[model samples]
Target: MAISCSFFLFMVFTMMDHHVGGHENVCEELRCGGKGPAIRFPFRLSHTRQPDHCSFPGFTLSCTDSNQTLLELPISVKLFVEEIDYISQVIQLSDPNHCFPIELRRLNLSSSPFQFLFHEQDYYPRGYGLFNCSQSTDQRNGIFRISCLSGPTHQVYALDLNDGQSLMELPISSCTKMYNIPYVPEMGDANILHLNWSTPDCRHCEQRGENCRILKNNNSTDESKTECFPRQRNHAKGRTSTKLEIVGAILGSFLLVLLVFAIYRVYRYDKVEKENQAKIEMFLEDYRNLKPSRYTYSDIRRITNEFADKLGQGAYGTVFKGKLSNEIYVAVKILNTSKGKGEEFLNEVGTMGTIHHVNVVRLVGFCADGFRRALVYEFLSNNSLDKFISSADVKNQFLGWDKLQDIAIGIAKGIEYLHQGCDQRILHFDIKPHNILLDQNFNPKISDFGLAKLCSKDQSAVSMTTARGTMGYIAPEVFSRNFGNVTYKVDVYSFGMLLLEMVGGRKNTEVTKENISQVYFPEWIYNCLEQKEDFRVFVEDDGDAHIAKKLAVVGLWCIQWHPLKRPSMKVAVQMLEGGDNLIMPPNPFATTATTRTNARIPAMDFRQELQVIPESE
Candidate 1:
């Protein structure tokens, strides 16, 4: 009976070894068109060519009917596989049809396991950023134009990714920027894109010029381990490799019995936290070399004195008056965001770090200790421009017409700097009276960049999915693309609304039911200008009236319903300086022209001649 049992066990063991070996043969390397790279373990063919457990997560590839391998990435990006170096765990991709450039606007590799691979000839380590500009935009040195994305309407360009700079520093003005892009990929080969995987890394095997194979599978954890293996032509006949696999299986089973399911849960939780942390740390790393000082949460408490003097509150965060020292005071805004990777927080830090203008608020420092984020700003004693411009009752506090004109120029210059002074363009989507702070001398400083966006100067128009800025101050194009594809004109429109509020000394949205007919300044102001009537606000002399009218005309030009009719900030600043041949802009309120008692304005929607006459002419 013992002899019979031993013989039976020997037969069972032989059958089990053959069964496992046959399964490994089934998952053997596959190729496309008989010339493509070998796709084996850690990368399996899609559509049931192999089991899901055979490949690492996010490593599935498909074979096209044309006998080519296709890789679909996050954000609907697709690339044709050119080659795969299994040893190095690197993949080479190409775009023969040139469709990759358009897909780049939607490409984000964060969800994928692969990252861009750098070449020896590549100038920028991370990747090149994309910018779509109009054909009229002047060309720049060291920048390459991507013709595949270019059309009669606009052209696309790529900028090098420097250590601490962005495409917004592109030094070409009058390029007529449109939409913004956020792409990071290797350059030097216009037709090729290279990416590398970290998981299942075969560095040891690669250094030794040998193949690596997944030998052990932790069934409960769904994990696998890769090890270097000697080159073998006949894998099934390799008894040494088979013996190693048997030993690995025995060890894997022993480890599986000792590990609990809860360990996996902890691993998954830790993985998610690490991913989130990696994203925040990556953003901070980009801005690390910038001038703004990084602070700890403990330092924030010491500076604010435990949130002692609250200055104000808004959608983004709350501001507190704090002292950097006895002589220097600062306004610290504790961001009201639990998401450290929030768009608002990143925007404030990213855009403000590079900006330095007299009329723009300074970023003193920032706090990013354990997700507790805060932005320290230069304190202005006079509060915001809204405090003085909101009501007309404060006679002593009101800035005179001359002072207001100077402030307007200062504001215009600031906007001009944001538009043209920087190498790239930065749009303040939430430009309003409240965002303009007042220094002790009442000089205006642009603040609140929670809604800011940075882009190349030469790109084309943008179509925003959501509206930005205060309701009354938001550009018409922001709400609807019918106002023309939204772009920098949105800022021009917000600037117009701000200028009108400055002249009227009231909010555009402060109308109540009791004063509905008597109030509503925008329409009322338009009527006064058309009917040759004096404004209700007090004016000292003819110069005040002239200054008010000039501001109104520039404001009117900026608030045009059609974006093409609005002046660029550069042109608006010149208009404010009284040199440009200014004209009363065709009324944007033409939809209400038929109901008015006396009105004369053209109803022409000049889409064909889509160009702003103010800045360009």
Candidate 2:
């Protein structure tokens, strides 16, 4: 039983070998005949039916029913395969263009898997040859050559199957002048035009006059047939040679597939790398042109001490204190990721990079590492101006009459610089006391340029859609502009409110019981001045009355209802510095609040009502 099983297994193995060997005869159908050349190996007839080794993945070849072949690439590219030579291993293709003249040339063998069969030792004794071709307007042609050292004599040639005459001919040397050759047996004589050389002795077998035969097959008649040939015959026998050829073809196909895959992967990797490099280059270009200091995320971590202490928080980011190597302190702001305000951050960085003024807060550096965005600013020890004036307790401690005036002037100068000093005029859309920071010397520096907008200096007024300034500080035209068009006077209005806050040592909207009737404090001050009543309550000291009056007049001038009526920061700075007590302002509350006549009549009516109550008593 064991011997029988072994015989059966041997028979099965023999049958399997016969089946495997028979698959090589599955000849591919050939379709040829066209004005152009027939498309062959290295490229298949269809993108889907291509040989596994012929094309790269995602890259395919298409042979149209009209006989034109096409190479499909990732990026849009169209090429027509004009000619292909199986013997010379070269292809000719034409570039389609309109204005540019189209020319035909040999396919770049180096770029493809095909190699020219050359005698290496004879053609290139040392190395390859490099050449240059120049075309002259005078129709002059230039030629240059390099000689081989020592080997068998060989000549450069190409196979032309299209002519149907000589199978071998010298290649038409037009533009290309560089080539490398390899050494082999009489490669020059074995051409399509002539077949004279004989096959050499088999390297593996020393048999004198051996022949090929089909050793095994399903049909006994086909298997019995065998043919022999002379040793001098150029071609080998059909069966044995076909088997070797099929095996070599399969191995070559695999190598071609691997080469194509490698090329595609390299191309894709390079393309992605280029795209990322382009993004980085674009960012760097903007940085270099804008002169913004870029910081890495790790640098930010060191500077902010891993975000140890928080200074404050806003809707979009948080501010942290950091110390630089110079021992100079800075406030680092880390922006929130969810907030879609990266454009605003970039604008602020771009604008601040070009601006350098004593009254403007300095931008120290910035970070834009993946997912992390931060801005570093020079630390202001005194913090925001709102800290001093908004809170009642801290107001008197920092903001004296003289100090307030100086701060007002400094802030005015800063706004003026933004409006005029820069190449482009900048508008602070959200100007308020909270946006102003004070230095060590109590000098008010305009901060938070995040909302600043750039406009051409030549333009008189900037067009705005939505109002951005603090509610109370926003200009009247910005809300109801039927009165007139809004302009830089918007900033003027905010500056006016800031000036009032400075002078009053408090916010203009005082919530005291005595001033409940006076909803608008500026109007209340106006009514007092109109009534010729003493406006001494707001005066901090009798000695500083002159300063007080100047501030009041300047504030009133800036708060004019119409944008055109309001003074520019340039003029306001002059007015504040000149220390001039100008004319009293018009009744700004006349349109909304009751007049002095009506107010007096109300008081008189109340008194009359009190007198009438006597009868009930």
Candidate 3:
């Protein structure tokens, strides 16, 4: 028995010794490639290594085909890492595209783990502007122009965006699209930019031959702080001191207890993760016949570079720019965990996988690893339609009226296809300008199936427990059952609102500086059509006038006060494509505020009463 006890003690001591040696070895050895500064600690190679091997999350590096190390930034930027100074915690970066001026105007480090080397450069308090010009200007205007990128027909200029003199010389009207960014010049190579990062100041302490340790918060008074001290300063003087031996044993025992606790916690975490994974698997079993690929959580993080470049954010999740391959880029939307029963995630994957229309965004893949969920979509260069029309200076960015008419026809066809073409009916509960994504050719595609519902094509009406849609575009029947049972006409109503916004060049319900009766844009258009006005906003000729009038007439017909009065999406498409004269319907809104309130209250009350009734047993 005595021999066995001593053997057990020896085994424990050996394990502790091996653990300490392993930690020291990890710090001493540097990870290196064929050339360049050896990377250690913070910066690690992602996918090729385990997360536990890295000191931090965002400090990951990837190797290029040419053996050069690359670091992707938060703004879809690719930077070649020229040098990494561990002592100073600075990384020297250069643009691989060799367009430093363009990069300087677009670089944003606010949400990143690093910042510009502020002390080395002449910092400008004002923001810089990147002007995309159609023709070169002979005037110097005190702005630094990128001559390498300039050509006879196209020129790019960089100047202080906020400078009154610069603005006067180069007005925004002259440029195609101007980009404003924080101005910070580089130190040595004008082409190279330097960024410094904040990390544990261990290099200085190690250089001074002192030991650094992370102090734990015992009473929760002080947060975790790194302290540097002499390794031998706290040593006991006497070799024969029994107190020292007792203290050593107690400390070693405490460490063993902590190690055991860590192992147990890891086991519990793995169990929970497995359970969640099972749930996701079971939920997606119904979609096995679908075409879209399923991705794991690690796959999602790798695809998005840890959510580095955010494209946009909506109520459900934030979208990030991702690349599946060198030639295939995708938009990965990481769904919020707060969503109920994963229905939204299921809806997006199910509805989009079956859809293959020119005007519908395609789903490339999806991630359903445990609680981490993400939907991958084909990347569209032109982004959403709202960006074009909502811009205050729309002349430069917005496509002309002829193109707008094409986009309207394309959208109407997409809606028509959704109602009639699909084997099972898909109700796009949300159909607004924001959801209408545009492609490179100014073609509009309807996106966002988070609120979409699937029903049989034979069913005329869809049952809903709650109102689903954006406030401005929701149909009246969706808000209240008294107007009518919810049908595909709801989408038609939303499409009509979208059409009016496209025609009027503003929102349908937005109060503008026009006459009080014309504050609502659709009402103003109705008054114009009623009076036989020329429909003069951006109408250069007779053809433009006819297209504008057609769009307005169709919009009014689809937004009638009652669901039965509104034309179906199929009929609406016909009016847009054919040369049939559209007769405007009755006004959807009341003339007085009191009358409007009275019209809305009774229907809203009926919906409330219907919502209270329980399902039949």
In terms of lDDT, which candidate is strongest? 1
Candidates sorted by lDDT, best first:
1, 3, 2
- Model 2: how large is the Cα RMSD against the reference? 27.2
Compared with the true structure, all predictions reach lDDT values of 0.74, 0.59, 0.72
lDDT of 2 by residue, 36-119 (tens): 554432234563443453322332446656666654332343455555543343444433431001111222333333333334
- Clash number by candidate, in order: 9, 5, 0
* TM-score (C-alpha, index-matched) for candidate 2: 0.47
Give one digit per residue, the lDDT tens place, for model 1 in 276-336: 8998798567435447888888888888888899999877789998886435689999997
Error of 3 at 314 (Å): 1.5
Q: Report the C-alpha lDDT of model 3 over 1-617, residue by residue, as the tens digit.
A: 33554565677667655543333323221343668656555676654533443345467777787878888888888888989876677889878887676676657777778876755344645566667787666545446566656778877777666567866676457677556656534421267777877754456765776554444344655432455557453332432254456558857876676677668768788888899898778756743444788899898888888889999887788999998744578899999998778889988988888887889888888988888899998888889988776642356765777888899999999988888888887889899888889887888999999888877776657777899887667888988877887887889888988887777777544544564444356777877887887544677788878888888888877776567777777778888988466655655676446445544322211111112222111
Model 3 root-mean-square deviation: 20.3
> Which whole-number lDDT from 0 to 100 does residue 284 have in model 1?
64
Residue 385 in model 3: shift from native, Å?
A: 0.7
Q: Kindly give the stretch of ten consecutive residues in candidate 2 with the minimal lDDT sum.
A: 608-617
